[model samples]
Target: MSDIAKEIENAKRIIAEQKKRIKDAQKEAAKAESKLRDRQNYILGGALVKLAETDERAVRTIETLLKLVDRPSDRKAFEVFSRLPALSLPPQPAPDTGHE
Candidate 1:
């Protein structure tokens, strides 16, 4: 083959390799972002659970929200919250005016 033919083949190979590399990088980035999102959800859920354990409003709100969980598995996962006794939430504390 001529030199020009060989150079064209080499350039095409490089382009193909670069495309694969870009695709792999994008997949890796997407996976990392998914993991981060899951971690954030896990942390937020834990905080909510902790708050619900002590606060009447939080418990009631969480129980109310659980009604929206239509999936059997999700409903089953929420069984732990079902055991909290219903309680009247205390009036919310007034916000500080910062005037002092």
Candidate 2:
């Protein structure tokens, strides 16, 4: 009877340890998911900003090209090509990548 009781206590200890591990794992997974979501949001916002910058730059370049062209046909074509969707918001300055 004593040996049986000892075995039951040992089993309970093992179960308790496993339960703790499972809880820890669940918490870790939630933390990881939160971090992943933050990273994804950061990347998405950056990409949208980059695309806006590119569009703005293209429009400016096209305008300059149109001015430089002497022929009417070339200027018209460039004007048509340069037209793009209006930006929803003003473009933000790109962060400098050169600094450490």
Candidate 3:
């Protein structure tokens, strides 16, 4: 092939490789963003669970939110909530003061 034709083919190959690299980078970025969102949601869910332990309103809100789960597989994870205890913490035994 002529030198000019060889150069054109090399340029096209380089362009295709760069495009693939760009697409790969975009996919990696999207995956990272999705992971960040998952971590944030997990942290928020933990906070809500702690709040629900002592707050009736939080418990009610959680129950209401659980209703939004439409997937049967996901809904199964929430089945424990149906049998959850009251929001109040159980009474603890009195600590010994040694002054009695």
Candidate 4:
């Protein structure tokens, strides 16, 4: 085989490898983004639950703030929270008696 032909073949192989790597990287990035989104939703749900338990008025304030923002994500979050039923913390256990 001619030297130039071998060089051209090598270049084509390198290009194919690079394309595969790029595709794999893109898929990994999409997965990471999806996981991050799920984590964010969990954290936000937990926080809203806590706020509702602690102070409903605070939740109203957050709703107001969300209304003031123009972001679509914020509006969507507000809608989700609005649909949830009000939550309250369970009553604290009474102080321990002297008896075990």
Best by TM-score: 3
Q: Which ten residues in a row have the lowest lDDT in candidate 4?
A: 82-91
lDDT (tens digit, per residue) of candidate 4 on 1-100: 8999999999999999999999999999999999999999989867875775678786776556555755555444444443444422223445689887
Model 1 weakest lDDT span, ten residues long:
83-92
The residue-level lDDT of candidate 4 at 59 comes to: 72
45 Cα displacement, candidate 1 (Å): 0.1
Cα TM-score per model:
0.73, 0.51, 0.78, 0.53
Query: Which ranking of candidates, highest TM-score first?
Result: 3, 1, 4, 2
Residue-by-residue lDDT tens digits, candidate 1, 1-100: 9999999999999999999999999999999999999999989977877898888777767767765676655655554544453432233445599988
Better candidate number, 1 or 2, judged by lDDT: 1
Candidates 1 and 4 compared: the better one by lDDT is 1
lDDT of 2 by residue, 1-100 (tens): 6999999999999999999999999999999999999999979755655555667765565445445676655444444332243322223345589978
Best-fitting candidate, scored by lDDT: 3
In order, what lDDT does every prediction score?
Answer: 0.74, 0.64, 0.77, 0.69
Question: How many clashes show up in model 4?
Answer: 0
Candidate 4: list runs displaced more than 4 Å. 57-100
